[model samples]
Target: MFTDKLREGSTGPVAKFLFIIIMVSFAIAGVGSYLTPKMDFNPVKVNGNSITNGELEQQFRLEKNKLERQLGKAFREQAKDPAFNASLRKQTLERMITDQVVSDHIFNSGVVISDDLVKNRIREMPEFQVNGKFSDAQFRKVLSLAGYPSPLVFSEALKGDISKEIYLKTAFDSGFALPDDVAVMAQILSQERTFSKIDIAIDAYKKNQTAGEDEIKAYYDSHSKDFLLPEKVKVSYIYITAGDFVNDVKYTDEDLKKFFDLHAELYTIPEKRTVSHILITGEDAEDKIAKVAEELKGGASFEDLAKKYSEDSSSKDKGGKLPAFAQGVMDSSFEKAAFALEKTGDVSEPVSTQFGWHLIRLDGIEPGHGADFNQVKDDVIEQYTKVQSRELFMDKKQIIADTSFENPDSLDAAALAANAAREEGGQVSKSVQIKTSDFIANGDEKAAFPLNQPEVQKVMFQSELRESPVNSDVVELGDNAIVVVHVEGYQEPAPKPLSEVHDQVRDAVLTAKAENASGATLKSVTDSLAKSESLEKYVKDGLIVISGPATISRIKTGDVDAQVASNVFAMPTPEPGNITYKSFAGNNGSSYVLVLSKVVDPKLGADSARDSFLNNQIYNFRYGEDNQIVINSARAESKVEYNENREYLKMQEEQNN
Candidate 1:
């Protein structure tokens, strides 16, 4: 899809930026001084450029976040494993080292991006824009949120990415698909197969099969470890959440008024202005703007002139009408010009912004308003409760954490300390209480809230905590919810007696026997088919059912078993008027003897659109392969040094141990 867009000349600055995002580790484009070798620990050095421990950690966090989002709930279990985190860190470090090597190569290659291109790309980025135009305030606000000290820092980072993008684009262009490649892809995608299946149900094979006492005993003895119960723990804990204090928060009308007065600006709505413009950009913009101004001066309808000549594609079709916007949402110059208009239908002199020159006209305005005390009393009470509860929650959480650690044997002191903190904050005291949990076994998904939380489960089952029995360090269930647990009772894993597991062991042995019987039957059928014999006798005995012949294509493999369909297309084509047989074990304890009777190769069509699509598909695949090769080659040739004792990396190892 991306290759097609690129070929069609539709890929622009935004696409390029998305394609090669800034490599955060080596983004010091103009800030070379920050890259000077320091006494600080380095995790890896690529071609004399050191990747600091801090940079490695930052990149690791970003990569981890991306993975968590991509994997969603499935990543939660993996995140609890320290080993997975260590592996992620190693991968992150390797990527950063590769980026550093690429950054060095780009710098040494003398690639220079023109100033105008950089400025234009920056202005085009949606993150730095408001109302479809560049906004200095939004740009700086995003930079600050992203932890960049200033615009220069973020711009330098962006410039580095842009430079690397040049090299990547060249690499991508090196790949091309020939006519033969397109033909092959089209054939593979459009080929069809017709096959029949001999279905052998495992249960049918197992009808006369049975496991004896000896077989059950043997299986039980061999897999005793699998029969053991998981270790279990019952814990008493005291937890605090922001919501816990919400009801206890008492406030008077005077207090609400005080809060309302303190945050008066937040309650005031900013004035809104509806405006339109004729934007003249690109070659001879000044001349175009002057022409627009002259036409407007000659009593030309502003809307008509805007529809005729405005270069802002987003608004031109609507007579250059922009959505009503308040302060800080438009280019500073544009906002000033529109707001300075004295009345509706007033036109302003031509105004200039980073985008272009524009003639502005005000269409309508909505004056700002502030709510009186009584008008928003309910809102004030809710906001005040939220603020007070959050403060009290944090205070109680701190007291609980400290008290719990000091008195590690019980949650009583911790609970009392939390209550005291609430009392001190003028909240209802003794609302916080210690709660006991039912015995929670390892990997127990049914455990109730707090216990069901993996963080809490991890602490509850700790060897030290279970044996020594201490109040656990505060475990945060979420941003504002935390719990401190003390082991009240514990049980170690133990094997179930053979007598108690006799039925389970017998079932396991019977399953194994059934699987063997099913395999033997499939083998017998395959051997019979190989000898040009038929399964008429077995079919009569009801041991096998032959499914009707069905046709399948790569794009339309209708109603066929997924496993059967996958293997059907991959099987070698038989000679004309010959049958081929392949056997497979089904996921549900069944077996299949696939009878492939025909293979249809796609005939090449004269469809130009489909040919282009196939060509682009192959081109994209080749481009990705070549891009990876370039990166791999750079990595293999780059001189990289690893700091085995970097303190940041050591922490992961220590945690896993």
Candidate 2:
């Protein structure tokens, strides 16, 4: 659902990385070398395959551009925040890893997704619909508009998603509960009650005394387990990207002319028209269009006619000033009629289309023109170079992969093969146990040892890594570099020293002690109020009684606190001077004392308020509990490995701070 609005090329790190690797491989084998590593191009290795920095940078730019459009003025400001950028990087990496995991699962399970299913899913999407039905033209047009490279690629993506959904459904089906259980929960939760209540303030105890040093230290000693620190990593990185070279590039006048001559079609502007309309509805729409056209022919006001008859609220009020558009941008019939008008102030006779009929007027026209050679030369050159770079990078990466796989033992052999295959100025570098974030920041990681990305953590901690001479998987870091890491060393997490968390332990102990002291006093005060018949007596004893015996149901009380409300609703009617009830403070530190005054049983009621309360309680309890149960069950069944690089998480936190 979140990916719905995104264009095909606008992907998170992992998808981009995968795409780049595949494309680069294809390009390398097909075309000669033009890619240069010095030109802000880097590669992340996964298993034996490489995802180029160039590809990732391109995808990142596309995504960034999309975000900029959405964010408008704040784009530059938001982009400058290091923490925000890090978060975006993390999110991209996580998505990529999750996708890889899902894809792996799909392959392992042998879940088949047919081409028809992908087609059906695409057809069902509203973007591909015309007149509430699937249209091939609309499908192709929408895909093109969404930047989908090809129908085959889009279909494959859909199939992957469908396969994942199917896998989830299969895995989770047994977790769903029966209707009877849900209904019984609904009935039980519907029961209501009338009650009296009072508040037991924790601030009442502030006057007691300040805690002593000895007490604080003792508390700290007892709560050291709660203060244990998570493992952390310190990382340094350098980033290389295509945009870095954009300003450095220059195109001479001669180069521009040559480029323009070679790619003249790219600069040729299509004929464009500005059209306005007075649309009318009803079965007699054509007759209305004809009448309006006749009236306009006789010098009747277009503005008045549009305001009177046009159903298009957006343009009709403005005398039908439609936005300027090029040919192939509008409905076929409408486009044809609008473009046919050669002169300004020309009006067509009635034109019929799907939405009804329109009396069209061509307000202006822009005759097509070829772009000046100097004006677009730089852009043309950039495009040509990018294409060349893509081909070169792909071929070089594949050679590395092939050589690495064939050798199957030495990274030196692989590196040698990569170097041999690379074009002029292209080079390969390696780092082990390095974080993906670091790789993204710095184009090379040779100075570092042991790549420590979250994706690598899985392999690093795996038992297989100990037995095998080499282990590798493609890791998609943020900005589209697919890294294939070879696990060199494995480190398991161990408990941190007590000295490392002395201050943290002290703070935890102090908070716990404060809560216990305040909570005990609050509980005593509430217990006294619940047991006493005279709420005024409790008020006299330094507690506040909130009087007005309102009929608050368990549902309303449940919203306050489910655990506390449960205890309150279970209480017997209060007796004079008797006190023994549980009390606790809410999240906002507001303590409540509930005294049972009356109980109402289930019955057929015309009372909408009562019915509504019951319905809410039933839905909340059953649905909430059932959803939790399903989630727990799914989590239990799945083999999830956290393997989070705490060092990376720490680095992110440090940057944020």
Residue-level lDDT for 559 in candidate 2 = 42
Candidate with top lDDT is 1
* Per-residue alpha-carbon lDDT of candidate 1 for residues 187-270, written as tens digits (9 for 90 to 100): 888888999889886566667678888888889889999899889999898877788988778888789999999867557665
Best by TM-score: 1
lDDT of each: 0.77, 0.56
Off by over 4 Å in 1: 1-117, 126-133, 142-153, 174-184, 240-397, 422-425, 428-432, 478-480, 541-548, 585-591, 602-623, 630-657
Q: Give the per-residue Cα lDDT of candidate 1 at 250.
A: 80
- For all candidates, what are the clash counts? 0, 22
